[model samples]
Target: MTANGTGINGVNGAAPAQAHQAYQYSKEPLGNPRPIRIVVIGCGVSGIAAVKMFKDRFHNLPVELALYERNKSVGEPGSRTVTQGNPYFSRVYVGAPELYEYFKGRADAYGVPDYVRLEHKVTDVSWNEKMGQYGLKIEDLATGKTITDHAEVVINSTGILNAWKWPDIPGIHTFKGTLLHSANYDTSADLDGKVIATFITPELALDLAPKGRDTVYSREEQDKWAEDPEEFLKFRKRATHILNTGFEVIVKDSKEQKETLAMIKKQMEKRLSKKKELIPKLIPDFALGCRRFTPGDGYLEALCEDNVTVRITDIKEIVPDGVITSDGEKVELDALICATGFNTGYLGVSVAKFPNYFMTTGPAAPAAHGTFIPCIEAYIKYAFDAVERLMREGIKSICVKEEAVADFQEHKDNIVHDFVWTSTCRSWYKNGTVDGKVWGPWPGSGPHFLESLAHPRWEDYDFKYRTGNRFQYLGNGRTIRELEGGDLSWFIKKGPKHTREELTPSTVSINGL
Candidate 1:
């Protein structure tokens, strides 16, 4: 989505110098701060955060926020973490259901649910150039009613894992079994002793299927965490520090990566010692953390079970009641679960051709390197910074310039080329392909991603102001600071951290117009 526009030099360029004269106001000061209508799609963590930010920061302004969510209630919208088998303890560390509650809880705590339009699915969104607004086609899931809405600003907080795809295979429909996509799994379907063939692995059912590993913390430890708030905070900080500092292990050809890989390989090989043949077939050859690496607790032991059979053969096709291997062996299965994958995206706060649009958690975000919470907050703040600029400057539309997007992409590609994610391996990071661009991770570590978005470069955007000129916001060569009760000396440094009640030996002030 390449857009052609000048940053601040061409026809749409900004010029503070109003050659003719300054704007003169009639009634109000700052002359009616342009009323902005903002629409948010997807009530995920990002969407919820956007609403909370609006309440916290955009208050007392003419900003209207409407959030549309597809689900009955707010929850974490998308990801690999939602469907992975065995609920890995170290990586894929938390349960999907629990994660859902956490996100929903955050929103509920902030009263963000009040602003949400639940059961409202956004079917399509497009920017109307003439109107200078984004038009959204929405469908209410409850009544099957469709609606069209427009907003001056649109935020797509819908994370990448929303779109799930079935693996393209011949005669897949012929399989006479309960087929399921991980994103749309039916929990009621009984998998007890059923011969399940999975593209990835099975779901929570396998978490404790006789051959399971249970990790239990001591009662005293639990009480300590529950009783002492400081203790819990300390633990969280320690865990975050570890995850953040371990970025070197994902660096291409780094000593840390090599050492970490060897340690994990030895541990996995030991776990699979009973069924040694599976080691060669299951163990990866690529760099560690290249794919979604999880400690599959009891997975190896389950494979060692009597009924468990491992097949590394390619699937020729699926016939009635079974799958035909490339080696002419037909394996029977009661169910087929395609944990195939989702359509990831190349995302930044704004994209070309989409004016006044923002994405909270997109494919290009720093997802894999460490904890995602900080990054999500950073993304929201970065996006709203631009929004604030538009509001303050009375801008109608602001789109990231084509050159800036191109440069960011180039830098991202170059940096990713040296990361483990871009190694020769089939991964969702590369859009479920073996050899393509890495789409699901930022170019650098999570901190780097956060740092990059810390400040927005104003010159990287092309903006069209509401009054048709950038200087229109200059507003009559007068400021509200000149009005009664306004702090005229706010620019001066406060005495000793604002300790002084008044300036010492104060001189009489004059009101000059």
Candidate 2:
């Protein structure tokens, strides 16, 4: 982890040979006479990656970059705590290595701040066409000071976990012991010896559980273990029992969608009739893989500890001291942790949420293949190659082609259909609308994701200005200055020299394993 001379070469142990080649700009040192003012919102994985890429590629080129985060530090919000604790499950799971390699160089050059203001909350966004800029209205949570940030380019990488969704159960707030959400879960020490009931599905259960721990395997593994039918049956029954007790799933019928519900009900009847034992396994009341996998490491094992109990019953209401179940029984508890996940179908500032894409076939998008898309790796490679080609021809900011979305989704749908895991149980992955429209850009596979982000393609989008003016290409020639323009001469100025210091470990932790 030694800091290399160049900003982008070091950090996270990336292979030197694979360091990203810096992108060269065209005729004008910068396309416009003004400094490219870029504002990045949220300091999560994607936001950090985008900012670092811009800095590494176009360092000291009159680029004013600012990042706004609601949290106090980078990688502390959402699932960041989970990933930092368990790298094996997260590193490859979410394409972290690719992000690391992409952003490392820039972080070395301009190190990220350790702490930021955590009290500001943005309420509204407005675009000022006359000023040719965007405005974000925010309120300071502590001081109540209202402030606005105006910028030319604003990136909304606010992430998916900012909002939490609660399940609508009758009289939930009426009887309460100590109800809380999983978002606040920082440590398992408090639950070391406590009764815990998880109202979640199998897909979500897997995420909360340890790695490689599942209720049952697919047919391939079943066949391998079936040599001893008697033993295998015992294990199978135990696994099913584990699933039932591991989490108290509130099997909400998918009848919310009348057509799909009727179809599922008909299929369930026949399937259940043929094999009653398979009822719990095959027919999930909620659609399978509609949510994220909820990981609860040390949760079930904690139940075996003293002074702990696990209940699998419908919740009736929250009473003062305990929870009343629909089965006419009340369970006494000290506290209750609601590991109820998040809502995914509708994201704020979403392209679908706002009709801003109407200018052309669509608004400007980053080349599709280079994002997190798994199935379109080859297409991403083609896209990145085009970006390099375009860079040679003097084009800097490349937008994704509108048609690429359709093309990418076509492959995503195919990948979804071929996945056996998708048919396992209901969760957030399929949190699509009743009409079956996807929300995010890509599926959940790392290799495919890396391939997709490998490069940019110029043909996919109509690269143009967000402002209502045609950009004049000067091809690396230094442009005539506008009043508020940033000067490249500042980069050439001699910076203050500093002595190198020996690196030392700052702190140690038990969870660093």
Candidate 3:
């Protein structure tokens, strides 16, 4: 029910409600332009968007924008990876089309070319009160050389997945075969005839098996067995393991293997039979939506291949050339693909250490509500909040309201317990210090998040505007009144709901809703 109303639980769909607005004031003509140098810490979607926005908005001013990245090219570990094909087409969010259009428009409007100082890894950040800026020390990941940069503002868009964490299973090093995380899963061609085991999340079941088994028992028969719990469980267990679409082999002791396969097949059948009923209860043992669901076009189908085996065995540790399970069995894997994901080093300390910088863009930490929507929503809020802070105060530089940072973290911690998703202990999204306790952001819905970020909340942040700078925040008491207003309001002040146009891929043209 929550999902239906919210469209997706956590996504905020209605237009953003109003907060206290900033007071607007007119200023006299500016004299000389002030120089503002900004350093954006990553070249991913967030960094690129921020750079372009700055160029377009502050083109006439003495503003210098520099982007630094550790990857040689754009779209590194955390960047947008566009997968081609009809199957992968839907992976890109619907909100992405608008984003593309926005970026394209900004690029065209400003002559600033996107530049990245690639192969640079940021090592440390130190605060300098004398300079009123944060100093960043970085190491060139390629050559191992150190570099430093200081700017009026520093944005850490250096996203999650920058570092990978491996399971601390003993004898892991002894396993002679290749061991890699899921991030290293580049292709499936190597899985041709070798036996491979993979850990798959239940969310990926649809992608794994798109079609029902050809030899499955009829629903009528299944329903008959369902009358008895013990009988049904035993039967279903058999069905979940066996059926596959690949080559079959017959060995001398294959009877036991056959039975094992049959059990898995039966279990899978039972799982599918109860899909609708289980949707509400299907929470992961770990956090439900913590780590991103590893999605591939045909990962499930690949697992169904005869040579590939899906196991739920609890791993003990890695043995030379194989893996040992808690059940006292050893699996010999040639290459260990660590499909395990990364560790997000979410700092628990206050962002106050960084001077003059305010939270004006995205979540200071990682937040994955529904990929694109909430990210944009939260980022925009930060943007408007910063602008409003500047408008209210005459001071040019301001940092995140120290109080808001604490409140925001406390708020984030409180939400971690309410949702079943956060109840799971296993997740990269959890607080680095606490288990089953997530310090990361709560996932919000895309549409809802967009509406929330539409308005600026001036009172929510601590801001100090600078009179030394030529720019000032200009605010009108527009109480985010667009959502409640009817057709009359649309006529009065042409709102985005009426005038917002979709950007087409071909030419820059507005297509109305």
Best by TM-score: 1
Compose the digit string of candidate 1's lDDT tens values, residues 84-174.
2222233333445556666777888988878889999998887665566777889999999999988888888888677777777899988
lDDT per model, in order? 0.72, 0.43, 0.47
Candidate 2 off by > 4 Å: 1-33, 47-54, 77-110, 114-117, 186-198, 201-300, 303-308, 345-403, 421-424, 432-445, 465-471, 475-513
User: After superposing candidate 3, which stretches have Cα over 4 Å from the reference?
Assistant: 1-33, 77-113, 186-191, 199-304, 347-350, 358-368, 371-374, 377-396, 415-417, 431-435, 463-513
lDDT of 2: 0.43
Q: Which model, 2 or 3, shows the larger TM-score?
A: 3
| Winner by TM-score between candidate 3 and candidate 1 | 1
TM-score-based ranking, best first? 1, 3, 2
Q: Name the candidate that leads on lDDT.
A: 1
Over 198-282, each residue of candidate 3 has an lDDT whose tens digit, in order, gives: 5433432323233332233456655666667787666544532231111121111235435544554455444534333332233
**What is residue 185's positional error in candidate 3, in angstroms?**
3.8
